[model samples]
Target: MKTRVRSADFLGVVVKYMVLFIAVFVVLFPLYISAINSLKSNSAINNLSPLQAPSHLDWHNYVTAWVGGDLGSAFFNTFFIIILAVLGNVILGTMVAFALTRFDFALKKYIMGAYLLVIFIPTMTVQVAIFGVIKDLGLFDTRFAMILLYLGTNVVQIYIYMQFIRRIPMSLDESAMLDGASYFRIYRSIIFPLLAPATATVAILQTIAIYNDLYSPYLYMPSSNLGVASTALLRFQGPYSDQWNLIMAASLIIAIPVVVIYLILQRYIFAGIVAGSVRE
Candidate 1:
């Protein structure tokens, strides 16, 4: 009986990890293939053996991709848009979340209900409405337009922050008030620090969203030269359409920021997700 129990446990563990390994391979194999191809010479790209290893690693593909593709300028422009969008989402999202969760205001229930309803509706459904507004505001084709669109689309994220904030004890607020701290002061000095884990989660999520987003840039910013990494990757394919090396190189570069961010915030992100998931 004891031997059978131990065997069952060992088999379960093996099965679990086998499934995990397969899932990881499914997700990462493409990226691994791209990275390997990016380092291969033109002739190696044509050879099936390049899948094993490049005969000689060619680093110049990275430089050529950056310069010839105008990726450097695209990187800077993308950086500016992402920075602005993340800042706006964090600051405004936090404030909105705080108000919705903590403050008691008239029509609060109605507003919250409306927000919840809107969350179910896809933003694409409102693209016509939003595009008109952007055009009327004369922000079409500007970085500000992209930033504003990101802000408007962040309602669900703000609601996530609000849900997490609500789980925090209201007594903390009462105690701060009793100690003579103004609401703003308490938020700045106390509440904000306590919410670091949640903020980190929100920031990481929005960073990935803004960084990886291509459709918004394509729709609003018509200038091919002013493209983000996603749009810029299109340059790798042309009428001929077979420079897999350069395409892979651009993709690897674009993926770097997301991977680095996940590495840095892995713990906080996990903590936030677990806490938020199991909590009321």
Candidate 2:
């Protein structure tokens, strides 16, 4: 009976792993095909099946995509936007979270309630209004506008931080206060260090979000040459048609940063989110 049960359990494990492998392959198969095809010469790609290995590697597509996409300037713009946006979220988010969690204020509940309400409201519904404000502020075609827009739209991150902060011990703040530290000092010196894990998670998530963002750049900064990698993919698709290999190459480049980030930080991401979400 024991041998029979063990056999059944082992079979179930094998079945589960097989199903998971199939699911992953199903999702990644197209991306793999694209990557393989991107390395083939145009003629080779036309002749060979996408699943087949490239007969001759054509690295020129990467060069062409980079030059045609004007990816250098776009990459610089994206780097700054992503960095600034992450910085804004971490700093302001920490502060907001600290206040809501550590300090007691009369309007705190009202403010928290407002944030909760606003969280569910879709920003797309206010596109026209947002554009008008952007124009009025004379930031219609500037990277600064995108930065500001990112800042405003990231309140959810602050709320996440706030939830996490509530889990931290109040005694730490009390000890800091007893030692003649100000609120800002306590935050900077004590709390911020401990929140590194959460901040890292937020940075990784926000970086991906801001980097891949295309619509805001398109709508707000259409005349600006500071397009992000995501928007630059459009150049591969002409009015007449699209170049599949070039598009794939450009897309693969655009995807590299996000993939690298996830691979590097994924070890901590879920733990941080869970810890932040359930903080006492």
Candidate 3:
């Protein structure tokens, strides 16, 4: 009986490590190939195995990609858009969440039902209509168009805020009301400040999503001056399509921001998720 238990534990340990190793390889392998290919010339890449490192460091590919793609402006554009999207989503989501969870209203259940309904519908199906609306609004080919699209609060943010707000005690709200504090005052002064963890998690997530979004930036903002990092990569495609080294370097360059962001704030993400999962 003891031997059986020991064997089962050993097997579980082995399986867990195996799965972990495979997951690590799945993520790191492509990044490794991209890094190696980005360092070599087109000729060197064609001749050598992707797993092998370049014989000599070639910094020229990065320089070419940066100049040809106008990555500085693209990065700036992406950064600006992400900041606006994160702020808009967080503020609006927080307010709506506070209203739904705290106050009793006539249309409350219907409003919640609507949010649930929209999440199941895919965004791609509505793009044709969305595009027409943007044109009608005169927001086409501008950063504001992308900002407006992303600015809307989504189901995920609403749920996260609700979860955090639920955990906050109602006693604090009642005490503040006794002092003639308005609902807005109680929310702004007490509730919002206490939601720092949830706010951090939401901001990081929304920032990363907006930063990495290629579709909105590509479709809505077509002007060269408005090109984001993902769209700017298109410049390498028309004439420099054969320049795989430049393409690889450009791809890796654009991915750097989100990677750094995830690494830095990843702790908050886990904390928020775990904390939000439990309710009193």
Query: Which is the better candidate, 2 or 3, if ranked by TM-score?
Result: 2
Top lDDT model? 3
Please provide, for model 1 over 1-280, each residue's C-alpha lDDT reduced to its tens digit, 9 standing for 90 to 100: 9999999999999999999999999998988898889898788888856457686888888887877677887788788988888878877877777877888999889988886676778777788788889899999988888888888776656666776788789999999999999989877887677777677777777777777887778778878678787777665566226777877777787778778988987887676556544533
RMSD of each predicted structure:
2.6, 2.1, 2.7
lDDT of model 3 at position 273:
61
Sliding window of 10 residues with minimal summed lDDT for model 1: 271-280
Better of 1 and 2 by TM-score: 2
RMSD of 2: 2.1
Candidate 3 residue spans exceeding 4 A from truth: 1-12, 271-280
The numbered model that scores best in TM-score is 2
Clash tally for model 2: 0
lDDT of 3 by residue, 166-238 (tens): 9999999999999999999998999999888889988877776677677777888999889887788766577
How many residue pairs collide in each prediction? 0, 0, 0
Candidate number that wins on TM-score, 1 or 3: 3
TM for candidate 2 is 0.92
Flag the better candidate by lDDT, 1 or 3: 3
